[model samples]
Target: MKILFVNTHYFLPQSRGGMANTLDQLCRGLADRGHTPGVLCAFLGSRDMFGLATRARIKVAAMATGIGAAHDAALSYPVWRAWHPVDVLPALAGREQPDIIVAMGGKVVQVIDAARQTGIPLLTQVHDVEFDWHGGDFAHIADVPVVANSQFTADAYRTAFGVDAQVIYPFMPLDQYRTDTHRRVVTFVNPLLRKGFRLGVEIAALCPELPFHFVGAIPDVDETGRELDRGMLALPNLTVEPFRGDMRDVYAQTRVLLAPSQWNEAYGRVINEAQVSGIPVLASTRGGIPEAAQDGGILLPADAPAERWATALRRMWNDETLYADLCAKAVHSASRPQLQAETQLDQHECALEAAINDHRAAHLSGCQLPA
Candidate 1:
């Protein structure tokens, strides 16, 4: 089967985090299984383009999907709208005529509409609750079948829309972490401008004796990082290192992963990455963290006050047996078929096949839109 995967965020090779990595991994996995997959994303930055000025400009301009106003704004207008109908995806679709289009989040709603215009079916992967902003407007284009990253996200989709979705947890490769363990500090990996980072910083400051390293580029880090550096350094116990270079090194030296997210965390990949590193995680109960943890690590209430988080950190630090148990549980959870590629790809294929077949039946009965 040929599938065109649309990502509204950065899909470049070096792009960081879940959305980009998931597209890269899933596309590769599908290719290995004899399915052809193509990716489309709006370019945000440019580099090494002295001889490719026009191409760089086109790439940069195609990335503007919508205006941002809300605190959690990835769900605004589909970011790829600038390049949609006639941009990269249409060119690829005209050439490949993909069997289906799978959109990861609300940012790709325009991609879905354009594909539907070409009489191709769409499969939206609801990564977070759409009601957050993009969900409601995008719901008008809800003719496509859907997939959710977790039961939490899936339930949120059903609560907003009347339809339920097939649940597919994001899969991660664990073999890379097998022989790497250089423990010393706590680690948090995500965009530093987010609430996840703020909460993480607070937790790290609360436990000053243990170093807290954040690994990820922050847009406002130069100005904000300088300010944060000063404040964190003043504690004499906290270290705010801008996430630079390979992340494996960061995970290697980290004993524990901390995600004290207060808002806008659809699912904490840091929690899962920590599990792969054989480290225990102490994360807030938000979005899909609890669903993702699955008895793997410690789960605190989403609204647990800062005082309680500090107390929990102290308790977790002191209890070796509990820490060991959580680490073991994390590994056990990671070992499951759901988190691995081969197994996850199989689940994806089975669900896609079933959904496609069911959709065909509906089309034949004049229930679904004609392709």
Candidate 2:
């Protein structure tokens, strides 16, 4: 089957976030299965970042809109209506002639009319809870099916828009992450407040004896317009590392992974990555962290004090038997049937096929779709 991904943002070979990474993996998986896959995205100069080898694997059709950084805001319905990809979509779709159209992220509704006009089955992939602001207006479009990344997100959609979405966990290439390297340091990625940066700093400050690595670029200022905390930097044991595309290097040196997110995370991909590496995670019980962690890691309340985080870190570092037991559980949990790439891909394929059949039936029966 030929599938076309209508992405609002650039879908690069090595994307930073879960949504982009999942799309890249899905496209590659489809291509490997002898199916043709292409992407229609907003031009964001991401193509220049792709190396010669990565650019050759997938075909991309980027819409050229002269508006610079405003393109990112185009996911908003008002912004999208004024600067939508409607003009370019038909032409691109005509050339690719995809069997099914998968619109990713909150900008799915932007290409709904074009997909409808082309008479192609459209499936919206919802990644987060803020879809109401993104593309919730046309979510009730009868022929379009929605696929949520997790049960938490699926429930949110059901409650907010009465959309019973199919839950398909995001795909992570487990084979590539599997390793025999010994773990050593505790690690944290993307040190933003919502991701528990402050808490991580406190944990690092309290456990000054153990080495802690904070990966990813740090923002100059936080949400409150205050200078970013430099306390973590002051600690002799803490090392700040830049964002890395390939996480194997990060996991290689990580004894425990910290995901102390304060906000309700839709899905914590890092938790899965760490678990697959046989590294136990110490994360807050925010949204899907429990689900992501499964039985692989320890979870504290989202509002857990700095002392609690510090105590957990100290125990993991000092208690060799406990650490080994958690490591064994982490490996076992990651090896669960649901976490497999094949299972995820199979569910995705089934959802797409069912969407095509359902859309065709609705069209043939002349059923009036709900607005």
Candidate 3:
């Protein structure tokens, strides 16, 4: 099948977030399966996220509208700024005549018109809950199947918009993460408040004997233009690091992964990444994190006190037997058949084919597509 993915954000390879990684893997998976995959996105900046050229398997159609970083930052909804450029999607679709269209990054509003115009089977992949941007409004688009990254996100859509979504967990490249080497440092990525940076600092302070690595700075800055939280920097045991796309190197030296997110994450990709690397995670029970962690590691309440996290960290580090058991479980969880990349790709292919068939049937029956 010829699949075209329409994204609001620049799907650059250097991008460190979960959405970019998932899309990259999906495109690669489709191409590896002998299907044609293409990406259509607006150019956010000169540099791509991966700091590398686009892969040969995936064809890219980037719309350059001369809207630079300053303009993007000023907009309340930066993604909507790409709507003007994305207007070309219909023309592109007409020429390519893709078998299926996947609208990602809550850009459904921008793509809905083009998708309807093309009369192609459209599937909206919801990555997060952006209430302010009306991300869930994609459910109202006729004949467009909504695919949620997790049951937690699917339930949110059902509850908020009365829209049912097919749950397809994001795929991760487990092979790249398989490593036997493990260091003693605990690693945490994207140290923003939403990601439980405060909790991480508290844990670091409590376990002064053990080293803690804090990776990635908060994207936003305060009125004074300071991004790093002073409290976090003050911790003697904590070592701050820059954000990177691939974390295999970091995981290679990480004994434990911390994903103490306070926000309701759609699906914490870090948990799966850590598990695949045989590093147990101590994630909060926020959104789909518990589901992501599964039986690999411990899940504390979202509002769990610092003391609770500290205690858990201490036990996991001090108790060799418990640590080994969790490590074994992590590997087992990641190696599960259901979590395999092939399994996810197969599910996605089936869903795409079904959507196409459903669309064709509806067209033949002279029936109006579902709202």
Model 3 CA deviation exceeding 4 Å by range: 47-85, 134-136, 222-231, 367-371
Per-residue CA lDDT of model 3 for 1-371, tens digit only, reads 99878876764433456787787778878888989877766544434432222221112324243322112222111111232435667776776688998888746766765677888888888888765553335546734678889899999888977778888888777886676656679999877778887778888898889899988875455445667557556777888888665678888889889999888889888887888877999889988898788888888997988889989988888899999999889988888776788899998998899889988987889976689
Candidate 1, 224-314: lDDT as tens digits: 4454543543556555565543567778887777776666566766567668767878887878888777787777876777668777777
TM-score of 2: 0.84
Candidate 2, residue 31: CA error in Å?
0.8
Record all residue pairs in model 1 with backbone atoms less than 3 Å apart, i.e. clashing: 65-79, 130-135
Q: After superposition on all CA atoms, what RMSD does each candidate show versus the true structure?
A: 6.6, 6.3, 6.3
The Cα local distance difference test for each model comes to: 0.65, 0.74, 0.74
When sorted by lDDT, best at the front, the candidate numbers are 3, 2, 1
Better by TM-score, candidate 3 or 1: 3
Better of 1 and 3 by lDDT: 3
